[model samples]
Target chain A: MIDVLYFAWVRERIGLPRERIETGAATVAELVEELRGREERYQAAFADLTSLRVALDQELASFDAPLAGVREVAFFPPMTGG
Target chain B: MRIAVQAEPFDLGAEVSAFTAGVRGAGAVVSFTGLVRDEGGSLSGMEIEHYPGMTGKAISGIAAEAVARWNLVDALVIHRYGKLAPGEAIMMVATAALHRGDAFAAAEYLMDYLKSRAPFWKKELSAGGEAWVAAKDSDEDALKRW
Candidate 1:
């Protein structure tokens, strides 16, 4: 099981900040596809990969990165911090 | 070097003083503070959201890079996440070095990375309602300079 976290508008659209999911996905992109197939909200949140950023185990990562042994995955829009 | 990611507000003066107090070899210090801008008088406040586990780590990595790239004597980064009123400080970065050029360049480098690389989202609270601030394309362009 791995924890998937959504932030900003992604969380608003999904109505969740985080969730534990049991999956067999091999990579972050595959995991996203799995989530997108789950429900309408997930579909909306994961619709545009271009506007989203992903992190694996609290470190910024690419969607094609492997998910093996990773405990957490986070998705959010581009950061606006300063 | 030090990095702080918190919801609590901090004093800019105090922080600057503390950051530069013990420096023995540094001849230059540069400090930059970011504030919540109330443009056109519509903004009432701002809300900042950050990934708790990643905020500190990301900032530390940025600061470490700044120190190494510029040979900074010391560096400090403090960013606050939560509700803040207009004109209130959102974050600050300070860098000390042997000369002004290094200090200034390092400070700008830190700002550029913090704006795009850090995992913090900002929502502007205005009379109409609250809306997430979009990441400007220029911010990404700013990264090319570094």
Candidate 2:
């Protein structure tokens, strides 16, 4: 099981902050595909992969990054911090 | 180096004084503060959200990089998350070095990295409604320079 977190508008669309998902996906992109197939809200939140950024185990990661022993994944729009 | 990610407002004056006092043999100290801008008359307030586990660590990593690259004597970063009114301080970065050039460059580098690399996301509340501020392409381009 891996903890999945959503932030900002992604959380607003998904209607939650975090969840624990049990998946056998090999990569972040595959996991996103699985999520997009789950529900309409997930589909909507992930409609445009270009606008989103993913972090694996609290470190910024690419979508193609392998999900080997990662325990946490966070999805959000590009950061607007300063 | 000191890094703080807190929901409470910080006293900029006290922070600067404390950071400066701790630095030894530094001839120049530079500090920058980011404030919540009203941006016309539409903005009512701002809400900042950040990843709990990654915020502090990410900032410290960036600060460490700044210290190494600029040979800074000391560095401090303090950022607040939660509701903030217009004109309120949102975050601050200070760097101390043996010369003004390094201090200023390090401070700018820290600001550029903090703008995009940090996990913090900001949403602006306005009369029209609330909206998450989009990350500017220019911010990403700014990081390429460093």
Candidate 3:
């Protein structure tokens, strides 16, 4: 099981901050695809991957990166905090 | 190492004292406090949102990375969530080390990574109404210096 966290507009779009999901996703992209197939909100949240950034186990990771042994995954836009 | 995400303002001196008082072998401490600023006089108020558990993990991860990279002794990261007025402290960082070099560098590195890494969003509430603050290109550039 992996924990998925959404932030900012992603959370606003999905109407949730976090969820626990069991998946066969081997990569971030595959996980995103799994999420996108769940519902319209998920589809809208995962739409336009260019604006989204993914982190695996709290480290900045790309969508193509493998997710093996990763316990947490987060999706958010380019950070704006200082 | 304490990580707080709250709407309440934090006392800088108190935080520094608490951090130093808890950790030994910390000879230097460096801090950076960011305040709400009007970006081009467009934003009046700011509403910050963050994922609760994820935020702690992210901040701790970045702080750990800084500790490893710079040989820091301890670190603290406090960020405010929810609505904040102009000039309010948005976030603060405190890094402790055996030397000033480590403390200062680690503090800055942690700040840079925190800005680009943490999953917090800010929307500017202005006279025109509320709008999401687009990620600034300058913030990305600042992270590159690390």
DockQ, all candidates in order: 0.92, 0.91, 0.59
Model 1 accuracy (lDDT, Cα) = 0.94
Best by lDDT: 2
DockQ of 2: 0.91
Report how far off residue A69 is in candidate 2 (Å): 0.3
Candidate 3 ranges with C-alpha deviation above 4 Å: A1-5, A14-27, A31-44, A56-60, A66-73, B20-27, B40-42
Better of 1 and 2 by lDDT: 2
Ranking by DockQ: 1, 2, 3
Candidate 2 — which pairs collide? none
Q: Write the per-residue lDDT of candidate 1 for residues B75-140, one digit (tens) a residue.
A: 999999999999999999999999999999999999999999999999999999999999999999
Counting only residues 3 or more apart in sequence or on different chains, how many pairs clash (N, Cα, C under 3 Å) in candidate 1?
Answer: 0
lDDT of 1 by residue, A2-67 (tens): 999989999999998999999999999999899899899989999999999999998999999999
Q: Write the per-residue lDDT of candidate 3 for residues B1-146, one digit (tens) a residue.
A: 67787889998889888988876988898889999888787778799887665678888888888888888888899999889888889999999999999999998888788787787888889999887778877778987777
Q: iRMS of every model, one decimal?
A: 0.5, 0.5, 1.8
Model 1 RMSD, rounded to 1 decimal: 0.8
The residue-by-residue lDDT of candidate 2 on B67-120, one tens digit each, is 999999999999999999999999999999999999999999999999999999
lDDT of each: 0.94, 0.97, 0.86
- Where does candidate 3 clash, by residue pair? none
**Poorly placed runs, candidate 1 (over 4 Å):** none
Q: TM-score per candidate, in order?
A: 0.98, 0.99, 0.78
